[model samples]
Target: MAPPSTSKLEDDVSVAFRNPSHHSNCAAELDNKHVNDQDDYKPERDARVWLIFLALSVSAFLTPLELTSVSTALPTILNDLHGTDFVWIATAYTLASTAVLPMTGGLAEIFGRRPAMLASLSLFGLGSALCGAAQNVPWLIAARAVQGMGGGSMASLTNIIIADLIPLKDRGLISGVLALLWAVAAALGPVVGGALTARPGQWRWLFYLNVPIVGVAFVLVLILLNVRAPTGTFSEKMRRMDWIGNFLVVASSSACVIAITWGGVTYPWQSPRVLVPLILGLLGLVLFLFYEARFAREPIVPFSLVTNRTSFSGYLQTFICPFLTLGVIYYMPTYFQACKLASPVRSGIDLLGFCITLGPAGVLGGVSVSRLNGYRVQAWVGWTLLIIAMGLLSTINEDSSLAKTVAYPALVGVGGGIVYAVASFPVLAPLPVKESAHALAFFSFCRAFAGVWGVAIGGTILQNELSRRLPPSFAESFPGGVALAYATIPKVASLSEPARDAVRAAFAQSIAVIWRVMIAVAVLGLAVSLMMKAVPMHAQTDENWGLEKSRDGELEGREGTEEGSDEKRIEKESIEAVI
Candidate 1:
């Protein structure tokens, strides 16, 4: 792949621009040029690549595991810490990670990818260790913040590294494998957490587990990963660091996530706690946008990349679909325990269907894309399955059978696998190789941000629904607060039959509401997927289409040239319309 051209960048700024198809040869020519400079670019394939994948996969595992694992242990953590703010354990990590995501791409670029990745793993492991040793709720929250910072880099950088090693045509298959790993980690988290909480002195073991894995990953990366730096001196690379841009991104995202997580949970949406941060986050975002557009040498997120309708719409679909899917994953366990009266262990086991199906579906989707080269069909299939899953889930009730629960989650998991397989392809396919890391990072960032909103919105929905459905007789059952008392309630076997029945009825209604909202979100995502223009699957590879060489000897493709001058006219008009 060739480096990006300032000339093309200028042309992209012109009032008239063509679609990507018109310049299909650009990517291919650039790839040939890069291959000619094979001596300068030593592309090695050793067993180390798989080792790197495994190490990064382990780091990635810790992220979703941390998120899901804590749910099963929240009761124990709250009791042991003597704290009512159990939500902080999850929220703090999420908020910190979301805040730091935008910087990972830039950091990887400025520093070598290997160094940046190893640093992320080390920080995450240290934070996990700290979390295990925390004596109080504050310490735990602080430790989680450190973990979040490390997690931010891991989530984004993993994809960036994958993009670096794998060709676009093969990325779908690799991405499928990564998606499977993610699903497994997410699904297994609760079970592992439950087991640890159930065993003596094992709750701390959850965090401790990360230490050895990270240690091994760090050592392997240091020894095996060979990353090429940009053609510049150390000072030149340092100059490109974009510290101000990174700071602005972190501040804005952190504030926004905090507001989202805290709103309607710890504080009223309209209260100062929410309003102040909301306003500040928005202001910081506006400033960041202004800076990126006007002043930064190498902006963290480029507007031109995001402004393209295909990329923009694809990103939105990426964000909203996962937001709804993960929202369900986060809350479904509660429904199983509260409504079905299942044990925590049983609830965790029930979630395995979703996790187990994801691996095969993702692998299938990846293999299918590799053979067929057309992602549009897969996108449609995914959306259809997602809609069906959401629709089925909406029918859940007080006496819903366990079979329906398993079926709905599995369907959604399959859709998730397909979506993950195809979603990033469209977003990354159009860009030059140099921009791939940034694009991948942005894609991951959007998903992480979505996860935060998913948890927040799902929690709010459940809380509100439960509040509305609470029995009048139980209104005085807890003088302190219903939310607090609800937190303490164990699996159904712990409650009397009548009390269990009441809780089940309330939980059933709440889950139904949540599922309805999920359906709406899924429908919106499906609509967005429809709007996406279906590019040919052959367009996935830089080697397939010929273009030219840029400075870095990577493929340089000419895009936005397919439509006639009239189409370019339309592009300008569309930009104006949005403005």
Candidate 2:
């Protein structure tokens, strides 16, 4: 079979040089060849690729599942461990993942996708194992940190891998598949966690359930995947790992998230506990930029990519869009369970309206991109839907019907599906094939960063609004209330009917305010989407090698050869048989 186009081969070579463990001898044999011999190259579909996809998808399942599932089990874990600092259990993982995400993309570039992915999976599985065995809250939090390291990589690498094998035109379809998988996990997490907690095992099963799936995925990848290592000596590539840049990035991002998570919840926004960390994180971020611009040989994120107008805009949209969409996801379940008085199971099922719609919409968007060669239309349509959804949702109140809640979420899901489908195009379109992995990593980093801030800002608003509004209502309801009355009222279920009504009304009003704020954020996202420049989809290029395709749309050297002349003929035939 004929070898792949020189441009495609360079990407494969880059991966090989990045990780020596996955290097193939064939790569060395063809190292100095200007053009791969058409007769020598073969193309065949490998079932192993599907296996790898399944393995990688497991990580995707765990990442979002961890996010949505933990809420249901938090009460159980807190009760069993006798813990008050419940927020830390969730925050630790988010902090660690957000901190590490910016660098994982660069690390994948330097280390090769396969090795980087395996390492991430191992870390994630190990964290899950530790969490399952935790005897206390501290242990559980620590384990989550480890899990975050792995989780960060998982999110980044999934995008990186798609950019590697799938062409620009086909990416949408693959992305849709990925969205479906993520949606399944998101939709299932709460119900699964509630079931586990309801059983005698408490919350341990939440962590334990990840073990078998992750373990199987890890083993499958190791055995079935054959990745081409980077083209140069392993040590040479290792030197390019950008450790200082990575550390600074982690420090800055972690500090910032910690500040956001703690402010107004654990400490006043103006207090030192919040202010000091926020300042430090900002400084760390500044220093990281300086380091990337001046000192680092291989910056964790290339300044060029960040500076590119289209790419920069794309990243900004990613960061902001999730803030609006995911913030709603985070709070809506609570609104249902707490304000609407739905059971945990019922709330989980209700939340499915949004999550369930995401997969098919994402898939359809993606598949359409393959044919349409652009996603600008889909992007705009999605933002419109999201804005409408947010607007509809903002009108929700204590008296809102369950049907209205479900409709808005499903609309947002449709929008999310479109956004997720097209977001990758801008990031990967301008880069060379060799840089696709890094580009994807950066994309992942931006998404994670946005999610962190989304939750933090949304939570802060809800908490502050609740505190300010609830107390005034409480005071007005009991005109002669003393300090003890103020303290006792919130804790008592047997309060006078009027008092209960007042408190519930206060909650309803506060939540309405929060949802209105979310609506504004969603509108901002819609605006950002409008500014995004639409570029025509182009095939991947390899600038490093100067390989170009011919006018007939074939790579150079493939002009006269029949398809069977390539070695891939045999492999393609085998693949066909399997199919």
Candidate 3:
């Protein structure tokens, strides 16, 4: 009923890392394999490979840039667009991104990586153009969904391509470099968004700016990215896709996000608007998993990916870390604006402490994993630090000093940076190289999906707290219960003394709840991460997806291998028998 255990040989190798005395042959084999890996495929030594990595780095930069920039500019966007619903603006991007992530591995397999990547770039560019031109709220939300689809696919593809090019053991420094780019983009995003929003109609430039950058990255990918395409007719390729699985995932994810976004904010939690979709979405997901496990000819998320304790822990940690990090990123600006009375530009500048620390720490973390050849310790250290940071953050009040404001988030940066850099190791370590695409797609999906909950839950807590904390008369003046936080920010500056102080304290206290929840989540992450064993990283890249060298330079013949034929035959026999 299931495919052969792909990780069996790797799991045997991993035992050597944990107990070398009893498995000396495994150790010797692993060491010799690494020696061969160094000589055979070192992308660092190839100029063209460097260019391709550069292209991926640039593409990777765009996703975080859009995410962070939108956060700083959101309050301003709501005012300019005359929109009451702030949740949809943020939720739409993440929802679309999460829904599209599960199928990207299959897309890369069916269509070559280069073509899939180029298509994603095109969608991103087009969405950016539409976002810049949008004059209303709904139109902008729709356009952001489009941009999200592209961004999500690109994010998965970059890692997928990197896995194709470099062995896992050698990917540390490379991962660090990409992490640095991410930190830079994240740090720059808020500042850029704030500067653009400082002037009337200037916010359009935020979206417009992405177009030219996308154009450059697209051209580079088209010219230089020459990875191997799968061999098959269109019909054959179509048959291999898990179409039903993809549709179920997309539809179910959308329904769930819509429910989460609307619950307690746009509608009462008890209302059918919230309950029906939530229930249906949960049921749909269960059905989807069942279909994938029992009936699909080629499953996108094989049960093997999650059934193992080590990989399951990896997925859980991946989901939780981003859940905490995004809550901080999205809500910290609100704290600056509402409690500290900082302007959009000032708030963005205030975040430099966090932005500056995250990048270098990530590089250090990745390098440590490479040098030490173990990811479990680094992850433990990271989660421990994050727990401490979140605890300190919860102690902030209205009268807290700027030093606390700046220093606390910087602590988060350090811990988050470390965890984020090496989070993929445990998931990939015990798995075969061929499973990288599926595993990484699910990895990216978990990360993106967590963001949806992070923002939604943080907003819900803040709104409910504000309702209780704000003066009764003042609360009544702003009609919509949960929707009033963003609207109340601009008005905070004009309030009378006692009321003003009350509102500030309310905001400070409400935001602290978000941090308190992060503390609990971080602790859980730390505990879950302990399930990860010191599995050895892979020393080989997927042979099927490796780069295709130019004929004039270096000709490498493809081995005649009937890959996945046995799995296909098994699936055919099982289907004929019926589930």
Candidate 4:
């Protein structure tokens, strides 16, 4: 049975933003009644809180830094370590990260967010240290997976902490800033990786560089940020966690990712390598959901959050939006290199337009949401722009100028910035403060999961189009003239003159075809964005609305009355739980 109705969930979460302190403070007090003994929390302008947020942002930036950096550095790393298992280098981290995300909330609940964050940071630092020192591809892959766990945790925890600290009214602005920082990090990652790989052994420095930064962030968090622990005996907290559910989800989702990633890339879609995992992963997913809904004491993704229109809608939107964005991100450089005949450096430079526009676009989108105190309009605007961007990109041929190509992809970036600007608001807004961590975990999971799907599906579409567009010519011209050649930028030198022209034409046409498919994906995302209902952001607090707004004396009196019973109940519960 569902624990809370959709309307009830909304009421439990939604606040009168105008007087957030009263609504949220009292609501939190009522719910916990025991956990938060430190009655004074940080105000909006607290230097300490903002400092903590900044520190968290650095961790957030670090996650994407590793993600984008590895792509450019992998070849160099491969050169030094030299293993056929090179493919697993990237996939390992992705699998570990995605598998670990569902556990983050429960970890936070048990360990407390501060301890969880510190643990994650420490683990990532250790992983980075190991990665820098690795002598073999397999060992490096293992380190990357360890790093990914920390990266995944940091990504989820940052969002959860942001929601914990910021009120509904101001979250958009902060979200925008974070998005901007991510954009900067993502854009810089390739450059940093490429620079490090300029020398044969320099690639190891990429991981090495992170250790010091992580150390600083760890010290800062340990010193400045403190979160209230949930009220429970350690055993009760352990019992409350859905350990079985976590295992099932990790197993199921990791299996599915392995299937999707290897399918049509490393293995044939029909190969047992692909099919068995696909089948098992699907079964596991169903089992995980069933356990969460029916048997788990505390579900990772609670039914209330899943069923609530706004929360579910946000989840859908997050999954699909990134699915589209990742496709573009994955393939755009290929388009520049193959069709436009640009050097890798030139290609990376061309991508700067996207990097630059998205940062401001994200911030602007956030500002719009914050000032308007409405997110639906922003959603419509963002998705519509993406749909239009993808559609425009489909028109590009080999003859299309760099200016046109640059401008076209920039639209997708702009749309990404806009859509992602308000990403967390809808998910967290309609859920209680308690569920914020779960919502953020789910949201972050969508982004991570989309990475696998985007690259695999986009590669499949491009390869299929190449096979369709140049059937006889495709087989004859290239050295290895099957779909796999097109999988990663197919070299055109194997073909002489007219055949080479045919190859280029095929490649360009194939990219256009992918762009058209992306348009459909964008359309799907836009369609879902329309389903998001507008929740009110502003509320009048003078009427003793939501959280109690008692006068100073009255507030003290109420606290005094509740203190004795609350303390007694807490003591009794703790003792009973321990016993």
Candidate that would win on TM-score: 3
Report, for every candidate in turn, its global Cα lDDT versus the true structure.
Answer: 0.73, 0.70, 0.85, 0.72
Residue 180 C-alpha lDDT in model 1:
82
For residues 128-224, could you state the per-residue lDDT of candidate 4 as single tens digits? 9999999997889899999988888888888777666666667777888888988898688767876787777888888998999899889888876
Give the higher-lDDT candidate: 2 or 3: 3
TM match of model 3 to true structure: 0.89
Ranked by lDDT, the better of candidates 2 and 4 is 4
Give candidate 3's whole-model lDDT.
0.85
lDDT of 1 by residue, 305-326 (tens): 6766667777887898777667
lDDT of 3 by residue, 1-579 (tens): 345454754455455446656365544554565445433544433888789999998899998888888889888998899886788889888888898899898989888899889998998899899999999999999999999999999999999999998888888888777788888998998899889999778888889999999999999999999888988888988888899999999888888888888877778789899999989998999999999889987798987898888889999999999877787778888899999888888888788777778888889888888898989998999999999999999999988999999899999989999999889999998887778999999999999989887888788788778888888988899767447789889899999999999999999999999899999999999999999988888777766687776674343232212233444444333333331
- Greater TM-score among 3 and 4 belongs to 3
Candidate maximizing lDDT: 3
- Candidates in order, TM-scores: namely 0.83, 0.81, 0.89, 0.81
Pairs of residues at least 3 apart in sequence or in different chains that clash in candidate 3: none
